[model samples]
Structure formats: structure tokens, C-alpha cells
Target: MITLKNVTLRRSAKVLLDNASVTLNPGEKVGLVGRNGAGKSSLFALLNGTLHEDGGDYYIPAQWRMGQVAQEMPETDQSATDFVVEGDTTLVAAQAEVRAAEATDDFERMAHAYMELHDAGAHDAPARAQALILGLGFKTTELTNPVNSFSGGWRMRLQLARALMCPSDLLLLDEPTNHLDLDALVWLEAWLKRYEGTLVVISHDREFLDAVTNVTLHIDAGKLVRYGGNYSKFEDMRAEQMELQQAAFGKQQDKIAHLQKFIDRFKAKASKAKQAQSRVKALERMEKIAPMLADADFSFEFKEPANLPNPMLSMSGASFGYPPPEDAPAGTPPTVIVQHVNRSVLAGQRIGILGANGQGKSTLVKTVARALAPIGGELTEGKGLNIGYFAQQELDVLRPLDTPLEHMIRLVRETAARGQNHGQGTREQDLRSFLGMFNFGGDMVKQAVGSMSGGEKARLVLCMIVWQRPNLLLLDEPTNHLDLATREALSMALNEFEGTVMLVSHDRALLRAVCDEFWLVTRGGVEPFDGDLDDYQRYLLDEAKRQRESLKESLKEPVAATTKIAESEAPKGATGTFSLKNAPAQRKLDAQRRQQHADKARPIKRELEGCERRMAELTQEKARIEAQLATPLAPAAIAETGKRLKAVGDELHALEERWLELTEEIEHTAGA
Candidate 1:
């Protein structure tokens, strides 16, 4: 267990935690959450021993090993697998000792070193490291690639894999899912679930917190508060506490008001002057209860599009991929990823693009966004179509040296150049105000984009996107850097949006909240996915299992072939076991078994489809109720509506769980 008692921490002159205390038990998974710069990272630094508390006691077991993702990009030429294997210092040391003992011809030392290596699992370290790397979205062929060859984001993934490879009692991960795709994020969630260690993770992804964390440690107002459950439960508990606090504050205000009235009425009279003075003293003596501070409420809406064109875009036999390499032969063709992708994006459609990393989800998005052209086929945009594309890489759209105000100014100028506007001229003051809506105000608007945090940059990009008032939004990982508040704000805006949205995000909460349907990009093709995020997850797991089985079969083929040749070379009378000739029959039987399993799952699939349809209806109804609740109504009407909303919400939640269970059942039946 680790404990911090009366810990006072400060950075320079700014106090982050004032006598804060919290305890984390061993093997506990805690989510560290707060607004940016609320000292979440500072507290992490304190735990990692990089920073000391100004005044308090901190305790952790002395011998326990701690592991954390390295922030610095590795700049080495070492193979990726070797770099990950180096995370296990004990194994590396044991291997080194074994090498030294062998070189010196010391039999006793060599024996001891070999035993140490065995205990440390040194022989299997490469395979374990490879597994971690693969789980983090690295290709198997890239295992032998040089570390320095990877880009910054991939290097960060390598760092995460290295941290996971480390044998530690305490693991610290700060936004580990930031650079990962949905497939990798799902894999990481499962890996963390099985991790037998204490985990402290800082993440803005709410679904991730709910899936992996059992405790939530919130930093607010320079104070540390520990909640007993995950992020959702923490929110509920916090809301209840705020409600009680608000009640106490209201009571305190009422008492103060009555006392003030009595004092005003009596203080002027000589007979009751003493009594009035007593009242004044009592008022002064009473301890004031502060009103509960609400979380920052950020709400913004995209301006109605100038045109709502049905079928915003259509592709015919479109091939989406990168352009041909500069050094390629003169007639070389562009490398196509997704081919024969004939699809129509309709107005008001919310489509989530799903795929593994490097599987061309981004490619499809780019093609639709017109950042990249279709290589072999035509992509037709509707008349008056305007696209607001948010790239996964912030820097791809944002200028580093420019300030927020400057970025907005450029956007307005570009809009004016394109002769598209709301008739009101874009003024400098208006641009500043627009930036302010995204939380950029005062000096923040003037701050260089290069110096801004990832969340800030993302917000700037969003602000620019919304300013365009495009009819269709092509968002690729738009919430990657947003905090919970900003994400909620975006979700609300998207929900209220009348335009179409095509989103590719690893944030499951955002996807579930915004996307009405999903498109799966895989194996050089794109098609509609007839399921939700839960179903997609199950598909990924099933696909991984299939790949493992395929690899095993491939590995056995050569041995089987060698055995067949040997049997043929044997005497005719020799005992011939069930031969390779039966392999085709076995495969046929396996296919039959698969077909049987599918037949068994047919009813369950039908039930899941019904559940999904009901869920959609209930979701829309709940949204309608919520919108009604937000309006001004009589107290009785409001109460009735609120009760109905709660009932609907409960039913919706139950249906969602049922949908997940049904998906799992179908998956299990199929796999079996």
C-alpha cells in the first residue's frame, strides 16, 4: 500500500495540493482525474519520487518496483523487440551474468546464472516483449525494425509497451490510450484487467476509466478526494454530495437573511439594542458554509449549414490510399488500401469508422474529407457540399507558431476569400470572442499554438472547424486530446448538430454517444458494421483468435508435409496412421461445425438486433425527455417529466447491458 498524509505540494509559487491525504492499496486500479493543470501529473511525479512534498509524509514499500511510460521519445537504433526486452532489468542482468560466466568458463557461476535466467524468464523475454508490442498495435514484421525508424506517436506506443513489459508492483500510465486505435485500446483494456499490480492511470477517456479503474482519485480546488468506485460511480457520488452541500448553503443563507432582518428592525430601537447586538455577535460567530461549485459548463453549437444536401458524398469503385512514392518507377501505381468502396454518406448521418491501426480507417476518412484523392475511382460530392475535416494529427491542421486568434483570423480570411460568409464581416474582436467559446480568453488567445497543450490545440482545431459551418464533419480522432468536460461539450454539440458526421475515434464513450451507425474498414474494403462498439470489440477479439489459429496451422503445415513424405518413403506394409489425406476431411468437418455454431446463434442474433432497435428508440425518447426537462415548465410538470426521464434512462441502461450480453453470447457461440 501507498499512503500520503497531510501532503502539501507546490510548483514554484502555485500551490497544487494543500495538506491533501489519500491512500491506495496494493493491486488497486485508480483513475487520476482533474482539469488540466490541477496537479494530477504533479501528484504522479510525487509518487514516482521525482518530486517531494513540501510538507507531509509519503510512504510506499521500499522494495517494490515501479514502472511508468517514458515521456521522452527513444532515439536509439536498437530493434523494437530488443528495446522492449530491456524493460525487464532483472532479466537483462541475468542474461548478462550468464554470458559473463560462459566466457569465463566458470561452471559453478554459469550454473547459478542459468538458474537466475530461468527464474527471470529470460528465455521467453523476447516472446513476451513481442506480445506486448503486438498488443500495442505494432506489426509483427516491425518487431525487428529499428526503434528510431518509428514516428513520434509510434515511439510513444513503444514506450507504453516497454512499461508494460517491465516487471513492476506499481504501474503508472499517463494517457496511455492517446495514440492508440480502438483495436489497440480494447487490447490494452483486457491486458490491464489481467495486470496483477497496482495501476494509477491518468486519462481523459471516460469509458477507459470505467472499464479499467475501481477507484477514482479526483483533484479539485487544491484538494485530493478519493471515491470508492469507477468514474461513473464517482460522478454519481459527487453529484449527490453537491446536492447536499447546496441544501446546506441555502439553509445558511436563509438563517443569515432572517438574522439580518431582525437586526435591522431592532438595532434602531434602544430597548432591543442589546438584543440586536447579541444577534450581530451570533451572526459573526456563525461559520459560513460555502455554496457548492459546479463543474465548468461548456456549451457551443455549430451554425446551421448553408445547405443540407442529401447524399453529401458518393463514391463509385473508389480506391483510397496514399499516392505513389516519389522515387517509384514512372508508371508505378498508387498504393491502394480500401478498394471498390461504393458508399453514399447521407445528410444527418452519424457514422463511426472502425478498423485496426494501419487498416485504412484514416485513409477512408481522408479520401472522404478530400485531404487525399481517390486513386482509381470517382468520389462525387453533392452540390454545395462543404466539409469540415479534423485530422487525427493536430499539427496537420494547426500552425504551430500561430496563436489561437491568428488561426481564427486566418480561417475567417480564407472563408471570405472563398466568398462564403453569414453577411456580417469577420472582425478581430469577433474572432477573439469565437476563440473564447473554446476556452481561449485573454492572454490564452495570444499564446503560441506550439506552446499550448495537446487539449488546447485540439480545441483550437475544433473552433476552426465549427467556424467553417460545414454541412458535413469528417472527424478523425477529434477527442484524442480533449478532457471529459470538453468531450461532453463536443458530444452535446454533435448531438444537436443537424449536419452529417463521420467520426473515427478510439474514445468509446464519444463513439457511443455520437455515432448512429458504424462502417468497418478491413482487408482492402469498407462495409457497414451491423453492430455497436461492444460488437466491434467482440469482432476484434474473435479476429485475433482466428489469426492465432491460422498462424498455428501455417506453422504445422511444413511438419505435416515432411511427415507425409516420410510415410510415403516407408515400406508399403508399414503402419499408416490417419494420413494427410484425411486433412481435407477434417477441414470439411471443421467447416460443418462452424456452420452449426452459426445456425445455433441465429436466434440470438435476431434477438440482439431487436434489442438494438429498441435501444435506439429508447435513446431517442430519452433525448427528447432531456430536452423537455431543459425547458421552463411548471414545478409539477417538471417533476413528472423528470420522473419519466429517470425511468426511461433506467430502461435504456438495462437495454444497453442486455445488448452487450447478447453480443457476448453470439460471439461465444460462434467461437465455440
Candidate 2:
């Protein structure tokens, strides 16, 4: 169990946790949630031992191993399989022991080391690692690709896989689904459900938390509050709590008013002075109940557009794709991802774009947004047709060095240049006021966009889009950076908006809340999907399994499962007998035995190497924490470091013990 007793924590001058306490039992899947900057990450840091309490005590069982995704981008040429395999430090250490024993030329030690290596899953490491990779939406062909060859988002997925590969008693995942599409997210939820450890995840996707978490930990106003259910249940319970708190506060206010009135009316009279004084004392002693104030959660509404265009856009045999790069030869043909797509977007239509990652979803959206042109088909826009587009990479359209105000001003200039101004004011003050409505008030309007958080930037993009008052909204993964409050706010705003909407998002809540229909982009074509989000999820899972199975089938051996080295139970030179006494032949017999041992051990050794890397990581962290303690530090900080050191040390010891036990069984089996 993990316990924080009356913990008071501060990040700089800000009090993140004030006398906060909570207990988390083992094997619980907890969702840690709060508004942005509500100390969720701070609590995570405290749990992982990077931050410390200024007051009170925090404790986690010393023997429990912990796993967390590394925030840094991985930079390595190692194959993806090797990279994930190395995450298991236990296997690495076992392999090291084998090499050392072989160097010493000790036969018994070699035998023991071989057994340990087998137990550490040396033979099937790549297979297990590839499974994790594929589960996270990687192709089987990419299993042996260099890690550094992937893009940033894919690299982050790899980071997640590496964390999942580590053997741990506790796993901490922060925004684990931000980079994932729907298919990958579903796979991850299934994986976490099967994990036999304590899981604490921070995610903005409401459905994800509900799927993976059995408990909810909410941090609000410097207090840690535990809820006995998942995210949706937490919302319902909190709403009820707020309702009750408000009623209590109203009653308290009425009582206080009555007490004050009696005191004021009777204090001047001689006979009633004593009674009035008692009432005054009663008022003074009364414990006040504070009113439940809405926590200034981010909320906004879309501005009603000046006009609505029926059949906002029409595509006839439209082909959505990318043009050749500038460096490509002149005759190179454009890549057509989606072709022969006849679709119509009418006013007030809400559409959800459904497809696997890289299956032309984004290409279709890019064409609709005018970022790409149709290859060999007609795409026509109705008069007064206006689109407010949110690209998946917000940075692609956002100028990082520019401030929010500057971005708005640029929008205005471009809008005017196109002679498409709708009656809205383009004045600087009006723009500033509009930005303020999106929570970019005062100096925040001038803050460089590059320095803002992802959520903030996303809000800015939404603000600019609202200012345009477009008759059509094209949003691609708009909720990627938004927290729950803002995501809900967007959902509400979209529901109320009268514009035509085409959305591509992994957020199921948003899709369910706003989309009236779904358009699937698959096999280079587009068509209406007559199914709900649940059906789409099932389709994704089935497709993923089928693709993976196909890849596995391609790599399977033609030989029978029970194929072995001999036609009969006899020696190579002798008939119906086996002997090992031949001096030169003894070595061959021993070698054969070792190979047989390893081949038979494959089932027992499957998937152990990935955890061996975790042991190495802990060893390094233990050393770093030890060195940190050696330096002069604040007493509280030193205490925190000491706690972390003990945790790492005990975790390493536990891993070593488990490794020995696994090797022990394998050794006996191999010897027999």
C-alpha cells in the first residue's frame, strides 16, 4: 500500500497539496484527474519520488518496483525489438552472468548461467517485444527498424511500449493516449486490464479512464479526494456533492442572518442583552460552510455564424491526397490516398471521420480544409461557404514565435485580404477581448505562443476559429491537448453550434456527443458507416488482430511443431543406442543437450528480457539518488531523496530474488 499522511507539498511558493492524505491499495487501477494545473502532475512527481513533501509523511512499500514512461525523446539506432527488450533489465543482467561464467571457463557455472539466461527469456525476447510494438499500432515489418528512424509521435508510442515492457509492481502512465488513434487506444485499454499491478494514469480522454480505471483520485484546491469509481461515476458523484454542499451553505447563510438579526434587534434592550450576547457568542462559534463555487473551469460557446450554406460543400469523384514534394521529379504523380469519394456536407450536419491511422482519414480532411487539392475530381464549395479548420498538428498553422494577439491579427489581415469579412469587427481591442473570452487575458495575450502549453495553444486555435464565425467547422483531433473540462466545454459548444461540422478525433466522448453520422475512409475510398462508435471500435480491434495475424502467418515456419533432430531415439553412428563416453563426441553430446534445453525452455523464458532492462534502470536511479544525498540539501529534500533511494534499493533486491527463483527452476529442469 501507498500512504500519504497529512502531506503538505509546495512547488515553489504555490501550495499544491495542503495537509492532503490518501491511501492506494495494491492492484488498484486509479485514474488521477483534475483541471489543468490542479497538481495532478505534482502528485505524480511526488509518487515517483522526484518531488517531496514540505511537511508530513509519505510512504510506499520499499519492495515495489515502479515503471514510468521516459519524457525524453529516444535517440538510438537500435532496432525497435532490441530497444524494447533492453527495457527489461533482469534479462540483461542474466545474460551478463552467462558471459562472465563462460569467460571463467567454469562448466557448472556455465550450466547455471545458461539456465538463468533461458529463464530471462533470451530466446523469445524479440517476439514479446514485437507483440507490444504491434499492439501499439506498429507494422510487423517495422519491428526490426531502427528506433531513431521513426517520427516524434511514433517514438512516443515506442516510449509507452518500453514502459509497458518493464516489469513493475506499479505503473504510472501520463497522457498515454494523446498520441494514439482509436485502434491503439482500445488495444492499450485491453492491455492495462490484463496488467496485474497498481496502475495510475492521467488522461484527458474520459472514455479511457472509465475503461481502464476502477478508482478515481481527484486533486482540487490543494486537497486529495478519493472517489470510489471511474471518471463518469466521479462526475456524477461530484455533481451530487456540489449540490449538497450548496444546499448546506444556503442553510448556513440563512441561520447566520437570523442570528445576526436577533443580536442587532435585542442587544440594545437591558432585559434581552444577556440573551443577545449569548446569540452573538453562538454566531461567533458557528462553523461556516463555504458555498460551492464552480472552479472557473474553461468553458466557451461557438459564435453563431452570420449565414448558413446548405450543401456547404460537394465532392464528386473527389480524390484526396498529397502532391509530390518539391524535390521530386516533375513527372512524379501525386499520391492519391482516397479516391472516387462523392460526398456532400450540408449546413447543421455533424459528421465523424472514422479510419485507422494512415488510412486516408487525415488526407480526406486535408482536402476538405483546402490544404490539399483534389487529384482528378471535382470539389465545389457553395457560395458563402466558410471553413474553420483545426489541423492535427496545430503547430503547422500556428506561428510559434507569434503571440496569441499576433495570430488573431494575422487572421484578420488574411480574412480582409480575401475580401471575406463577415460583419465582425477586426479592431485590435475587439480581438484582445475575444482572446480574453478564450482565457488569454492580460499579459497572456502577449506571451509567445511557443512558450504556451498544448492546451493553451489549442484554446487559442479554437478562439481564432470562433472569431471567424465560419459556417463549416473542420476539426482534426481537436481534443488531443484539451483536458476534460475544456473538452466537455467544446462538446457543448459544438452541440449548440448550427454550422456544418466534419471531425476526425480519437475522443469517443466527443464523437458520441456531437456526431450524427460517421464517414469511414478505408481501402482508398470513402462511404457512410452505418454504425455507432462501439461498432467502430469492434471493427478496429478485429482489423488490428487480422493484420497482425497475417504478418505472423507470413513468418511462420513450414515444419511441424514436434520436429526434432533425429529419425529415431538413437545415436548418429550407432543403431538403437545413444552413448556419450566418446572423448570428442562428449562435447557434441553436451552441446546438443544445451540446445535441447534452450529449445524446450522457450515457453518458460518467453517475454522476460524486457523486464531485465527495468532492473538496470533502477540500478542507475539508485546510484543517482545516492549521489544526490551525498550533497548538502534542505532537510525535507534530503528526506525525499532518501525515501527514493530506499525504494530503488529494495526494488532491485526484489528483482534479484525473483530472478534467482526463476533461474532456480530452470536450472533444475535443464540439469534433469
Candidate 3:
């Protein structure tokens, strides 16, 4: 258990935490959330003791052990598995000493070392390390792989696994799900839910927070508020609070305005002058309730540029892959990643490109946006088709010397140079309003792009794109660093946006909420599933069931068919005696057929194994959804669940398709 007692944190004269008090009890899962630069991560640092508060009382049980997962991996010479195993350093060192003593055959040293190691539970270290490694998705063989060989993402997982393995009184995680795939994320969520230790995590993952956390710690406007229940329940309560605040602020403003009017009209009369002066004083003293953070009058409308009828972009027979060049040597062959992608991007259709991380979803978007040339396809452009493309790595393109405002001005000037300065004032106001929406205010707008956080830079880049108002918005991974509130606002805005939009995102909830249809990029091709996320999910469940049945049937096929063939091929010999020499040709044919059947069975067996894994994964997803549904449903939570279900369904359908193909092949081969 850890506690923050009226903690006050300040940096460069800005208050990060002002008299903020919070508590983390045993088994408490708290999600820290706020807008960008709202000190969410800073609070975690303060609690973890890496960053001390200016004035505060941070308390934890004296005997409690603490673990914090660093955003970046720490420098070490050990392999990935070794690093994770080293989490229990004391035990590891003792165990090593014991091993050395045993190797040297020093009876006295070995006896002392063995007792010390056993007392420290060093003997169980290897098993614990193995369990953690597997739980974090590392194969047993990968245990000895060099840590440096892994990517930053995998290193993060390693850090997470290491932390989880070392049992602590409390665990502090900052954006733990940032690098996790759905499977790992689900595993983590389940782990945290069942973990007995206290947990304080700073995450923007709504579904994650909703599933694991019992309380929400919200830091907004230099204030920390704790709400009972998960993220969704907290949001609902906050919405209610906002409504009340808005009403009270409105009434107070009206009262003050009326008082001002009365004072202005009756000030000339000596009798009323004293009363008017008092009323003015009262009005001045009245702390006019601050208005809720909502759209200001200066906020400009984001209207898509006008275009001719029909879709802005269309693709026929569009194929994409990272195949080797035709000029390559004769021994090499190219891989076809996606083929026969026939899709039409209509004027108002919102499409979502869904697939695994490396499945060319982004490539498809780039091809449609003309950022990349398609491998082989017929892509047609509609009249007046203007596209605003937002790449996942777009922030890297920002000029380091330029401030956020300067970036906007540069974009505006480009539009002017192109003779398209239709609404400069509207654009400028819109730019500022958009910046504010992303938590970048006056001073922040003036800050150099290089000085801003990754999230800030990303938000600024997105805001600039929206200012151009292109009819077709091609966004890849748009919600990467955005907070929950900002993501929701953007999702809602895009939903209301009157334009053709195609986005490649791993954020399932955002896709389901904002897009009208979904496309899956796979090894064979870009397949369009005809439905919303919910429909896709139902299809997954059905497909999963079908695959299980098919796998069962496949396993039974070889034995049953072989037995029947043996019975039918029973030798009939003259004099009621079977002669092996005479039936040699038939026997050879049967032997060849059996070999063929065996060959076919091998691939089918492999396919069946894959199908089983897929089914298991889907079942886990259904369990997650059922868990979430059992809890309260906020709009965001509902959207999150819907998207997860859709993903599960998509995966199931893919497995089922593979199962059918394999089963058909098996049947054909067995018949011969």
C-alpha cells in the first residue's frame, strides 16, 4: 500500500500537482488519466520516487517492496531472459555463489552457500523466471537471445515481465499497454486484475482501464479527483458533474449580468447609487464559475472541401506487396503480400483498414493516398479529389526550428501560394481551436516543435492536417499518443465529418466507432468484410465453432477412411486363398495411395493445430468481453467492447477459411 498525502509537485514554476492526495490499497487498480501535459506520468514518477515533489508527504509501508516499469529499457549486458531473471537479484547472486561452491567441491563453502540460497528461495528462481518469460510471450529458446537484438517494443515487454516476476508490495506502470499487442494486453489485464499487490498505472488504454481498475484517478486543471469504479463509470460521473457545473456557471453568469444592468441604469440616482456601488462590488467579488471546457465561439467549423459526385478514390484489382525486384537473380522469388484489393472510397464513406501490425494496412492507405505506388493495380481518381494524408510517422517530418504556430503559418502560406486562401481568418482561428482541442494553448503554440513531447508533436501535426480541409482524409495510426478524452473527441468529430476517410489503426474501438466499413489486409489479399464490428465478431464466433468441428472431423478422417479402404481392397484369391505375389501391383498402388494420404495428413494436422490456437484465442476474447459487459458500460467502454469483439470475429473467420481449404485438400488427396 502506498499513499500520497497532499502532494505538491512543481517544475519550472508550473504546478504539476497541487495538494493532490491519493491512496493505493492492496489489490487496487487505478488508471491515471488526463489531457496532455496534465502531469499524469509526472505523478507516477513522484510516487515511484524517481521525481520528488516540491512539498508533499509520500508514504508506503516500511517493509513493502516496490517495482516500477521504466519507459525505456535500462542498459545491461545480459540476454533478455537473463535480464528478466536478474529481477530477483539477491536470490540470483546467492544461487550463483552456491553453484560456484558446488563446482569447486568446497564442502564448507557449498554447505554455507546452499543454506543461504535455500533460505532466500534462490532454488525456485529458475522456475519463476521460466514462467514469467512464457507469460510475456517469449519462447523458451528466446531466453538466451541478446537483449539488444530485440526491438524497443519487445524490450518493454521484457521490462514488464521482469517487474511482474519480482513480487512487490506495489507496482507502478506508465503506459504499460503502449507497445502490447491485443493478446499481451489481455494477458496483462487479467494478471493485474488477479494480482494481490497494489497497482497504480498511467495509461490511455480505455478498455484496459475499464477491465482492470476499480477506481479512476483523474488529474485535470491542476486538480486530482478520485472517482469510484472503472474508467467508464468515472466518465459517466464526470459528465454528470460537468452538466451540473455548466448549469451553475450559466445561472451565476446570468445573475451577474442582470446585476450589472441594474447598476448601470440606476447609478445616477443618489438613493440607488450606494446600492448600485454595493452590487458592483458584490459582482466583482463573485467568483464567476469558470465555464466548462467546451467549444468556444472562436472555434471554426471543420468542413471538408467540396468535390464532384462519386468517390474521391477508387481501386480496381489493386495489389500490394514487398516483392523483390524483377531484376533480381534467378534463384530469388518475390512474396505476394496482398492481391486483388478492389475497393471504392465514396464521398462520404468512412472505411477502416484492419490487420496485424505488418500486414500492409498502412501500405494500402499510402497507395490510395498516392504516397506509394501500387505493385499492380488500376486506381482511378475522381474529379476534384483532394486528399489530406496523415502518416503514422508524420511527426518526424516537422521542422525542428519551427514552433507549432510557425508550422500552421507555413501551411497557410502554402495554401495561399496555391491561390486557395479562401478563408485565412477561418483557417487561423480553426488552427488555434484545434490546437486547444489537443491541449496545446497559447504558450504551447509558441513552443518550438523540438521542445514538445511526442504526444504534443503528434497532436500539432494532426491539427495542421485538419486545417487543410481535404475531402479525403487518409490517416494511419492517428490515435497513437492521444489521451482518452482527445481520442473520443476526434472519433466523434470524424464520425460527424462529411468526407471520405480511410484509416489504418490498431485501436479497434476508434475504428468501429468512426468507420462505416472495415477491410482486412492479409497475406493473400485485402478482403472486405461486409458489416460493422459487431457483425464481424458474430461471424468470428460462428467460424470458430465451424473450425473446431472441422478439425475434429479431419482427425477422424484418416483412420475411418483407411479402415474402409482396407475392407474394400480385401484380396479374393482362387481356391479361397490370398496370394501376395499375384496382388503385388494392387498392393503397390495401395501403398502409394497411403503415402499420399500421409503426406496430406501432415499439412492438415498443422492446419488443425493453428485452428485450435485461433479458437483458444477467440474464446479468451469472448471471456474478456463477458467480463467487461458484467461491469458498468460507459459509451467509451461499449465502443471498446464492440471493437474487440469485431477483431476476435475477424481472426476466427480467417482461421475457419484456412481450415476449410486444408480439409478440402485432405479429402481430395485421400480419394486418390
Candidate 4:
């Protein structure tokens, strides 16, 4: 167990933790959550003994080993596998001792060294390291590649793998999922589930926290607060606490108001002078309750477009990827990721784009946003279309040396230059006010973007996007650098926006809150996902299992073939050949079997199609009813519509279940 009693921690002259205390028991998985710069990292530092409390006591068992991901970017030519394997320092030391003992020709020392190596499990270290690498999304072929050959994000994965490879009693991971794709994130979640050691992870992803954590450690207002259960439970408990606190504060304020009113009414009268003085004394002595501070200081909305085009954009027979080389031969074709995609973006549509990394989610967004041209076919924009695009890489659009004010001003000038406002000028003061709306006020507006934190830079990018008054938004991983509060604020703003949104994000909460539909990009095709996030999760798990089974089958092919040959050569009737006399009968029997299966499946297939059509109709009706509810409607009409919508939803659910059953039945019959 680890305990911090009255711990007051500070960096420079600023206090991060003020008399805050929390205890962590053995084998507990804790999620440390707070705003950016709220001392979550500082707490990790204290736990690792790199930083100490400014006051009071902090204790950890001396025998316990700790492992944490390194923050510095690695620059090494060493093979990736070797680098991760080196994380097992005990194993490395034991191997070194064995070598030394052998060089000295000391039999007794060599025997002890061999036993130490066995205890450290040095023999299987390579396999363990490789497994960690694979789980972190590296291919088997890349295991022996030089670490320096990989990109920064891949290197960060290596760092995470290295941390995981270490043998320790406690493991600390900070923002471990930031550089990971959904596949890797899912794998990491499973890996963390099987881990036996005590774990503390800092993450802004709520779904991830709920999946992996048994406890929540929330740092707020310079206090370390511990809550049982996961992030969702913590949210529930916090909301209830806030409700009680607000009620008490309201009651206290009423009492103070009553006392003040009495004092003001009769303080000048001689009979009430003593009482008024006593009231003033009492007021002075009474403790004040501070107003509750909101979780986020910022909120923003997309400016409504002047025109709402029915079809905001359309892609017909389009291929998304980079342009071909100009100097290539005439027959050289453009490299495409997703080909022959036909999609339409309608007014007020909220579409979430999902895929594994490098599967063209960003490519599709870039092509639609006109940051990259379509490799083939046409992408037509509706008349009066205005697009707002948020890139996943903040630095790609942000000039590091420029301030937030400069970025907004440039946007205004660009809009004017493009004749977007018909030569209407945008003033610097207006830009400053717009920036201030994003929490970039006072001197902060003039602060250089290079000096700003990742969250600040991300906010600046978003502020610029919102200022464009675009009806269609293309966002790629917009929540990457945002804190939980900012993410909540963004989610709220997205929900309220009237514009069409096409977002690519790993944040499940954002997707669930904002997206009306989901599109899947995989295997050179883009198609609609018929279900929700839960369905998508199950699909990923099933896909992973299938891939593993395929690999196993491929590995067994040679041995299985050798066994078949042996059986064929040794045993009578082990293998049979079709005789000419029976060939006609066998063909007739095969045709009968095929016809029987087709007869069994044809009605199911037809019913499945019918169910799909009905499901689509119900979905559209539900959306229409929701839109009506959002408008000004009579209370009776609203109630009636709500009931109808519920009925439609229930029917849709039943239809979906039937559809799944039909699909499975058809597939099973065909395979048979």
C-alpha cells in the first residue's frame, strides 16, 4: 500500500497540491484524471520518488518496483525488439553476471549466475518483448527494424511497449492511448485487464477509464479526491455532491440576505441600533460559501451558414488518396486507398468516420475538405458550400511563432480575399473578441503559439474553424489534445450546431454523443456501419479472433498436408476417387444439395432485405420526430410523437435482431 498524508506539493512558487492526501492499496487499478496542468503528472512524479512533498508524509514499500513510460523522444539505431527487451533490467543484469562468471572460469559463481538468470526468466525475454510489440500494433516483420526508422508516434508506441515489458509491482502510464489507433487501444485495454500488478493511468478517454480502472483519483481545486468505481461512477457521485453543495449554498445565501435586509431596514432606529450592530457582528463571523466553479471556462458554437444546401457535398465513383507522380509513365495509376466510394453529405448530418490507423479515414476527410484532391472520379460541392476542416495534427495548420490573434486575423483576411464576405472588412478587435471566446483573453491572445501547451494550440485551431461560418465540418481526431472539460464543451457545442459534421475520432463518448451515423473505412472500401459503438466494438473483437485463427491455419498447412499424405499412402479407403459410372450420380446429388440449401435461404434473404428497408424507414422517422421535438411544438403533439417514436424504436430493435438471425442462418446454410 502507498499513502500520502497531508501532502503539499509545489513546483517553483505555485502550489499544485495543497494538503491533499490519498491512499492506494495493492493491485488496485486507478485512473488519475484532472485538467491539463492539474498536477496529475506531478503526482506520478511523487509516486516514482523523482519529486517529494513540500510538507507531510509520503510512503511506499521499499521492495516494490515501479515502471513508467519515458517522456523523452528516443533516438536510437537499435532494433525495436532489443530496445524493449532491455526494459527488463533484472534480466539484463543477470545475463551480464553469467557472462562475467564464465569469463572468470569460476564454476561456483557460474552456477549461481545461471540460477539468477533462470529466476529472471531471461530465456523467454525475447518472446515476451515481441508479444508486447505486437499488442502495441507493430507487425511481426517490423520487430527487428531499427527504432529510428519509425515515426514519432510509432516511437511512442515503442516506449509504451518498453514500459509494459518491465517487471514491476506497480505500472504507471500517462495518456497511453493518445498515439494509439482503435485496434491498438482495444488490445491495450485487454492487456491491462490481464495485468496482475498495481496500475495507475492518466487518461482523458472516459470509455477507456471505465473499461480498465477499478478506482478513480480525481484532482481538482488543489485537492486529491478518491472515488470508488470507474470514471462514470465518479461522474455520478460528483454530480450528486454538487447538487447538495449548491442547495446548501443557496440556503446560506438566503440567510445572509435576510439578515442584511433586517439590518438595512432598522439600523437607523434607536430601538434597533444594538440589534443591527449584533447582526453586523454575526455577519462578519459567518463563514462564506464560495460559488461552484464550472468544469470548463469555454463554450463555443459554429456560426450558422447563410445558406443551407440540401446536399452539402457528393462524391461519385471517387477514389481517395494522394495524387500520382507527374513524372511517372503514362500507364502508371494513382495509389488509392478507398476506391469507387459514392457518398452524399446532406444538411445537418452528423457522420462519424472510423477505421484502423492507415486505413484512409484522414484521407477521405482531406479529399472532402479539398486539402488533397481526389485521385479519381468527381467530388462535387453544392452551391454556396462553406467547409470548416480541423486537422488531427495541430501543427500542420498552426504557425508556431504566431499567436492566437494572428491566426484569427489571418483567417479573416483569407475569407475576405476569397470573396467569402463580398469585400466586407473584419476588424482586429473583432478577431481578438473571437479569440477571447475560446478562452484566449488578455495577454494570452498575444502569447506565441510555440510557447503554448498542446491544449491551447488545439483550442486556437478550433477557434479558427468556428470563425469560418461553415455549414459543413470535416474534423479528424479533434479531441486529441483537449482535456476532459474542453472535450465536454466541444461535445456540447457539436450537439448544438446546426451544421453537418463528419468527424474522425477515437473518443467513444464524443462519437456516441454527436454522431447520427457511422461510416467504416476498411479494405479499400467505405461503407455505412449498420449499428452503434457497441456493435463496432464487438466487430473488432470478432475480426481479431478471425485473423488469429487464419494465422494459425496458415501455420498448420504444411504439417496437415504431410499428415494427409501419410494417411493416403498407408490406409485403404483413406482417399476415394470418383468412378466414371458414379460421376453422373455424384453430380446430380451435388446439384440437389445446392438447390436444397438455396431453397432454405432464399426466403430468409428476402425477409432480411425487407427488414433492412423497414429499419431504414424507422430510423428516418425517428430522426424526423426528434427534429420536430427540437422545434416549437404543442405539448400534446410532443407527447404523442414521443410515444410513436418509442414504438418505432422498439420495432426497429426487433427487426435488427431478426435481420442478424437471418444473415447467420443464410451463411450457415450456404457453408453447409
Q: What overall lDDT goes with each candidate model?
A: 0.79, 0.78, 0.67, 0.78
Q: Clashes in candidate 2: how many?
A: 11
| TM-score quality measure for candidate 1 | 0.76
In candidate 1, position 513 carries an lDDT of 58
Give me the runs in candidate 3 sitting further than 4 Å from their true place: 73-80, 87-145, 221-223, 246-301, 323-335, 409-422, 425-447, 530-672
TM-score of each: 0.76, 0.75, 0.67, 0.76
The residue-by-residue lDDT of candidate 2 on 1-672, one tens digit each, is 999999999988999999999999999999999889889998899989999889999999998888999999999999888899888777788778866875874555655565465557654566677789988989755776899999999999999998988889999999999999998899999999999999999999988999999999999889999999998778767756765766555654654454344334433431333222333332232212112212334667777888887789989988888899999998999988889988898888878899988889988888888898789799989888889999999897899999999999999999999987767777889888889889999999999999999999999999989888888999999999998878867865786677888999999878876676789989899888877787788888788678656433322321111122222332455554556447476556656765676676555444234346778898688668757756877655654554455456557756654553454444444444
List model 4 lDDT by residue over 329-385, tens digit each. 898877888899998999988888988888899999998988889988889999999
Q: What local lDDT score does residue 363 receive in model 1, on the 0 to 100 scale?
A: 89
Ranking by lDDT: 1, 4, 2, 3
What TM-score should be assigned to candidate 2? Answer: 0.75
| CA deviation > 4 Å runs, candidate 2 | 105-112, 247-296, 548-672
Q: State residue 378's C-alpha deviation in candidate 3, in Å.
A: 2.3
- In model 1, which residue pairs have backbone atoms overlapping below 3 Å? none
Better of 3 and 4 by lDDT: 4
Give the lowest summed-lDDT range of ten residues in model 3. 289-298
